[model samples]
Target: MDDSELQAIRKARMAELQKQQGGASGGAQAGGSAGNASNDQQQSVEDLLIRLVRSGQIQKKVSEQELISLLEQLSQQESKANKTKIVDNSTICELTFPTSVLKVKMNRKRLLVILEEQIYIYSLKNMELLHVLPVRSNPRGVCGVCQSPLHPFLAYPGNNPGEVIIFNTDSLEPVTVISAHKSDLAIVSFNPPAGKGSKDDRLLLATASEKGTLIRVFDAVTAQRLYEFRRGSMPTTIFSINFEPTTNKYLIVSSATETVHMFKLGEPAKARLRPSNSETEAPAASANKYFTSVLKMLEPQRDYTCLRIPTNGNTGDTSSGNGKTKNLGSANHINREFKSAAAFCKDMVVVVTSEGYLYQFKFRSPEFKDGELVQQYSLKSM
Candidate 1:
């Protein structure tokens, strides 16, 4: 067909498509007048392009392929600009402490700031110091605070290595003092109410010693031991420990040894293999031994300095290594160590590394095999 005939056919086809779209969006047009206006504007733009082509004002007839390519280029440029954008974080108000601030915990009502040997509790609205409580000299900055609406409490490592002193946030009085471990306390934290089953009413406390060989859980109110899980014989720093928020069925422990340990809680003794079972079935149970097997150890694609456990379902890979057949365990291929991590959803986690690279991992099981890495962000320049 000649140019005029081809242009006429194309114009007719475009008009037909626009009519179909308008009919399909009639319900939306009724619900939103702005949407109808937008559609009208888009149709006008298309008509303008056809008119320009007919008038010979535009020398070139831009094909659909060329338009698509231009759009893709513009999208890529916009994405690049977004990725390189810098964020500014300037100081709003400053609160001076007698010593360096170790950690700060806040809720809607109060702000608890931890110093070298004291905790200053201030009103969130007024910033007035309501109470100042002295704690053991914490040089390593080992302390944790939680102020959940269901169960609120403050915890710190005691002067003695094994002791953990619990205090009431409202009364500023001692709730209970318990000997948690033989070695120095590394960290102490109160697990928020895991919103699952009948355990929603109970708050659990988790503690790790300075040696990092063992992690113990206790009933926060009764001060009764619930579960004890061993990390390893070797002394390592327990970077962070988090309980699954929904079921409390598992606990994730991240350590300096470049490992993440997942432990199944509330399992029967038989489920957790005994020494006798391991001795009798050495070859069969070797892969699932008591201490080593109970701890489902996971090494991330990169060394993770911190991690978060999902609450509702099993959401990590169970494969052996980074989904590669060759050079599976090679040290040269692993990613950089992660500095911190938090749960983004039931199946995804957001991780930040020491070098300021952020990664999101989505998996299907606790073993975290065959997982998908969604996006990686760098904030080093900012």
Candidate 2:
């Protein structure tokens, strides 16, 4: 009886030890699998961050301490392949100028850099000095250049308050002089042709004055005012004004005031038709003014520092037609002012803020009740 009982207890004890050892090994393998998964995720994020930095999409300087902290976090995961090392071997190519650069614009194959009293044109291919154009006391570097193939010219505020001088970029010669306003000129722009095959005969020129009260459009070929609209009675700075591409059916205006205005262009008249009976027709003096009318005035839910509308003929209506505001959960709270904005796609806009945050706003047309927040990216985190 004693020997059989002792052998049975020994067999059961041996099975218990084997089962416990197997369970411990299984737990260790599961923990290792988890670590590998984390390492893989960290590696993916590192690669994307580095690619954006090299492409100049993410522009920020990371502190040494912050970079070291990131590296330590990556190394904590048990994978040698995921241990990322931050490198600062970026080489910068700089173009030296005698004076401080005020504005830089690229047109076709030329690089135009505006300086205090002169505008320097450089070849884009090799950065060779092409020409140096002199100007009269341009302290603010207030100038605009047109890149349209139909009517390509460079314009800047003239010596007089109400003038603008247009210059041909190729010939380096003055094309024409325009007496645009009674007050100083603020900005000048030539309408961009709708398409590559479009004609330039109907292209128009837009100008804003320092008073910021009047915005006028003139025929590029005839140099005659086509229409004039009043912005506001109180003088303010005009941030930007753009005409819709191709059709010229709409105009977008932004000013110092925290509002953006869209105006619908009226149909052009070739000739004023006379009534069959002169008595039935209204007198010329009593006719209604043929100015562009404001279609919509938008004040963004979050105040923007800069705003822009796309003129590439791709922007169309973005309304859902259901009259509902799309709810985008607040993952990234925008606490800073917007610095600039541009059209990203047919119904999307990309806005950059002063705090180095990039926001993508979808459903962003005058037709929409509210712009839908699609995505938020922290550029500073890079």
Say which candidate scores most in TM-score.
Answer: 1
Cα error of candidate 1 at position 168, Å: 1.1
Show where candidate 2 strays beyond 4 Å: 1-94, 196-201, 268-345, 348-382
Q: Give Cα-based local distance difference scores for all models.
A: 0.49, 0.48
| Candidate 2 residue-wise lDDT, 301-379, digit = tens | 1111222222121223222222221222222324422223222223443333333444444533574433344445665
Model 1: worst 10 consecutive residues (lDDT sum) = 27-36
lDDT of 1 by residue, 272-371 (tens): 4445433467764565454574453211111112222221222343223321212123222134432332322355443333333434455344654323
| TM-score for candidate 1, residues paired by index | 0.56
TM-score of each predicted structure versus truth? 0.56, 0.54
Residue pairs with colliding backbones in model 1 are 316-364, 316-365, 317-367, 317-368, 317-369
